[model samples]
Target: MEHSIFVMCILAVLSIALANPIFQDFSQLKAVENANKVLQLVDQEVLSNHKLGQQSSLPQKIDWREKGYVTNVKDQGQCASCWAFASAATMEGQLFNKTNNLITLSEQNLLDCAKSYNDKGCAGGWMSHAFKYIRDNGIEADGTYPYTATKQECSFNEANSVGTLQNYVKLTKTTEEEILKAVANHGPVGVYVYMSSLFMGYKSGIFEDDSCTETPNHAVTVVGYVNTPQDQYWIIKNSFSKSWGEDGYMRMKMNKNVCGITYRLYYPIV
Candidate 1:
């Protein structure tokens, strides 16, 4: 009787094991995990509202003088100052577009000083939190200070803060062209994109596919836009080390919310 009971238990365990779901690869598993976030944005109502068509591409002949400036991020190495570098670049572009003179804000300052929101300096951070920091404490000029990607002592004088938080304009819900026109006409726009793996260290090309063949990791800035006859693209500047691609600059397809720009809830400094 005891032997019969043991055999029945083994059979039940084998049945359970065979019934479990088997995932082929990390991509499929990730898809399952990200499904909620995807549907939240890609649903019919939201997708139809974006009007993702009318946006322009990164012009083939990039007239830097007329379009705007494209700059690089000082190599931050393995540090987590990516958030600081990204935030500073967006703000820097905005300031540059407005004054017509480049301003290198202190990425080091944000890395060292911004501690309230659990931001791990070079580790990672959210654009919204970075903006909140700028709003609460005005940023300083690059000359007024310099960048130190590592967690260093905050030695800069507080009184040197240049612009106030009120200078930034936040957009709740708007179209891509509205944002691009804002950047072209007003200044740089701080956009939060769903960066995909293909975009990483991307050198040069007009991206069109959304296969997400790669995973989306960090966040970056849409400093400028371009409209080529072939395709529309966003001129993005990254905080990764210059060794990445084209000294940390790349072009992303404007189709299918490339980098998820359509769902972008952006803020800018006018």
Candidate 2:
């Protein structure tokens, strides 16, 4: 009976693997085996809904980069630092939208300092925790703290902080329209999504993997959205360097909650 159960499990894994054509070979991903380890970093409590005012009107299409509020793509390297990257990116967008200055905040600051508040640095972390750390202690500038792509001893200097969050809000899960309105009115928002094998191999085009899981894992930033005649997609900024995806950006199918992109959305108010 045990042997039969083991065979069934293997078959289940194989079936799912065959269903995904985008990433047939898991080896193509840099840290394929560690993908789950990376994704499991998000704190579930942060996924709760928070009361936020609804936007009266939002543009059909909005791009934070074109509006001059987003920073460049960052690389987390071999480390599972998506939480830190997303946090810093969202904060940078908030600061830019408010002050009109594109200042690069320090992901390393969160990777190190935030570990005290249930953050695991490179191993994994929640963006909510990172936001809380920034709100309480403030985050330093990238130039001041710099990113090492690995966990290090906390060396946060409040004196070098160039950005700080007044507060953050957790958007309603699976509410893509609400998330769209938030991103359009505010700046870029930090979001958590299930990183499928196909997502790891995504190169270009609108990503709509039917085989992808809905469980949230990896942290990313939603910068904007574009609506076309045939399809609508969200412009997501990833922390996998400029070489990955469409120059470190992925166009995910909008309104379907693709990979749970709307699941645990958050943005900082600078």
Find the candidate with the highest TM-score and give its number.
2
Worst window of 10 by summed lDDT in candidate 2: 26-35
Q: What C-alpha lDDT do the candidate models reach, one value each?
A: 0.54, 0.77
lDDT of 1 by residue, 1-270 (tens): 544543343343344434543312122222222332322222121221322224354224332324444354576655545556667767766666667767678777777766674455654554556666777887787677776646766664679876545444444445676656655554445555543434532556765556543223245666666765666777666666665556666676654566555544444353
lDDT string for model 2 (42-88, tens) is 45544434455566666778888998878889888777788889998
TM-score of each: 0.64, 0.83
Go through the candidates in order and give the C-alpha RMSD of each one to the true structure: 11.6, 4.8
Find the candidate with the highest lDDT and give its number: 2
Model 2 C-alpha lDDT versus the unseen true structure: 0.77
Model 1 TM-score, 2 decimals? 0.64
Report how far off residue 199 is in candidate 2 (Å).
0.7
